[model samples]
Target: TPLHLNKVRDPDDQLVLLPHGLLRHHCCYPGCPEFLRDLRTENDLDAADAGKAGDVSESTRRNGLWQHLSPKTWYYARRSDAFLVPRVHRIARGVMDEAQTLHHFVDLTMRKLEEELRGRPAYAEIQEPWLKECVTALYGEYLGIMGV
Candidate 1:
């Protein structure tokens, strides 16, 4: 069965979908930093839009690459039935490893945040604002993780 992905919404609530053919085209290619940066910018725009809406629904947000898949396609993916062609798979595997590394960095950062906040007063109860400092620390950690 051919897979169909659901429409994914961008920051402006514009519907977008990476057609299956395009996925096949790019799957084998290593993702460039510029391409990833553009995607991040688009996601930031979506977040801004959602914030302005004041009641953003989950459906309006992109959930990473999975957002490109329709429910049925996602199901197939989960079942490991949706696979890239062999040559594409080899390329995609490297991409997947990179993605995993990125995710691990994020997880480590989250853990660092938790450790830093462990004994601190809860955000609501804090008398002094520490958000800026915490954000700076996290951003520094992120940059270090990215080796930038």
Candidate 2:
């Protein structure tokens, strides 16, 4: 069976058949292994090209485009899960398993921060380079601790 490029759906149920090599570029993202597997399995070059009936040159090029440019298909053929799982896990680690308490804490903290920043007398006037840098660093540290 020939795998039609436009018919494949990704794990999230989004259609994966992007023209002009977009699929090849974005398949390396954190949660695309299932999509990559489906693409490779359905679009194998030799198998697809063997079934084509007309001009071998054009058929070969069109059929092989995904295979040629896909890093997941070429470089990590046997290790698709290995490539995607760790990154997915890292992202999931920051997400609260249960949302109630985390959401409440976040809401309260944000309100407090907003109040403190807005209450400052020099808040509008403190636009100096050092002050900006200090604010940026403080925000970064807060986010790091919050795992966001």
Candidate 3:
């Protein structure tokens, strides 16, 4: 019989099913697919949102190399995209390889804040204080727990 995965636990007792389609699946990005390679389960509807399934498989690759897949296209033949290239490199280096969706969302938010403040000398002058305030506003004691 095939191995079965039934339950995965998250912070808030969120339950994820197991290997519904494949044991694990990653992005189709050549440099970073599987960046978040979590175990997939049969009843896991999140698989679609996770960028897995009904797309290219390992066998059907372009130029014998892994490529990204979109719903409209398979094997997106190109170098890393400008927007996602940095994230790809980060995941590949295993520097920040945690699979928490909220964490990822927070990271993105912080990046956007920093980007907006870039090149503004006035903003830069108070960057640290402003950042602290923003963090406090959003997360109260959670920032302390996060060592912020």
Candidate 4:
């Protein structure tokens, strides 16, 4: 805790301190869990707008409450978590969420480019006439598309 996070040697190892999280003093700092109040549902009600008019029951709840069950309660919870985890991860990574596996084609394309280029290409300070012409043309086209 004595050393600052910015002093970390690895660039990628440093936390992505984007806003929302950056607005906070620390990420995931403990505070009161906000959820409270009550929820009430019953298996009896087919749907609220189903228009099956018989007398249904009223409801009441204290500190924390949940209805007994709904027909698709398990399915709802499953789908909810299916969305929530990835969202949390995406926010944590500053919107650069990655999947478990990179597609073979993308990997192959990148690898082929790497092999063809030998190492990172140095477009900056390009001395060769052909290479400088290519870079200038590419930039000219980019500026044209950008309407500059």
Winner on lDDT between 2 and 3 is: 2
lDDT of each: 0.34, 0.36, 0.32, 0.28
TM-score per candidate, chains pooled: 0.19, 0.18, 0.20, 0.17
- What number of clashing residue pairs does each candidate have, in the order they appear? 3, 0, 8, 0
lDDT of 2 by residue, 1-148 (tens): 0135335644433333322113432242334444344334334445445647554553333344345334444234233222221122222233323334544434443334344446553343233344333333333433454557
Better of 1 and 3 by lDDT: 1
Where is model 2 more than 4 Å wrong at Cα?
Answer: 1-124
lDDT of 4 by residue, 40-86 (tens): 23431233224345333311111111232223333322331211111
Model 1 residue pairs with clashes:
5-70, 6-70, 11-46
lDDT of 1 by residue, 26-66 (tens): 11112322222123236645765676778556334544443
Using lDDT as the measure, which candidate wins? 2
Candidate 2 has an lDDT of: 0.36
Q: Look at candidate 1 and tell me the lDDT of residue 29.
A: 19
Regions more than 4 Å wrong, model 1 = 1-29, 32-34, 37-48, 56-60, 68-143, 146-148
- Worst 10-residue lDDT window, candidate 4: 57-66
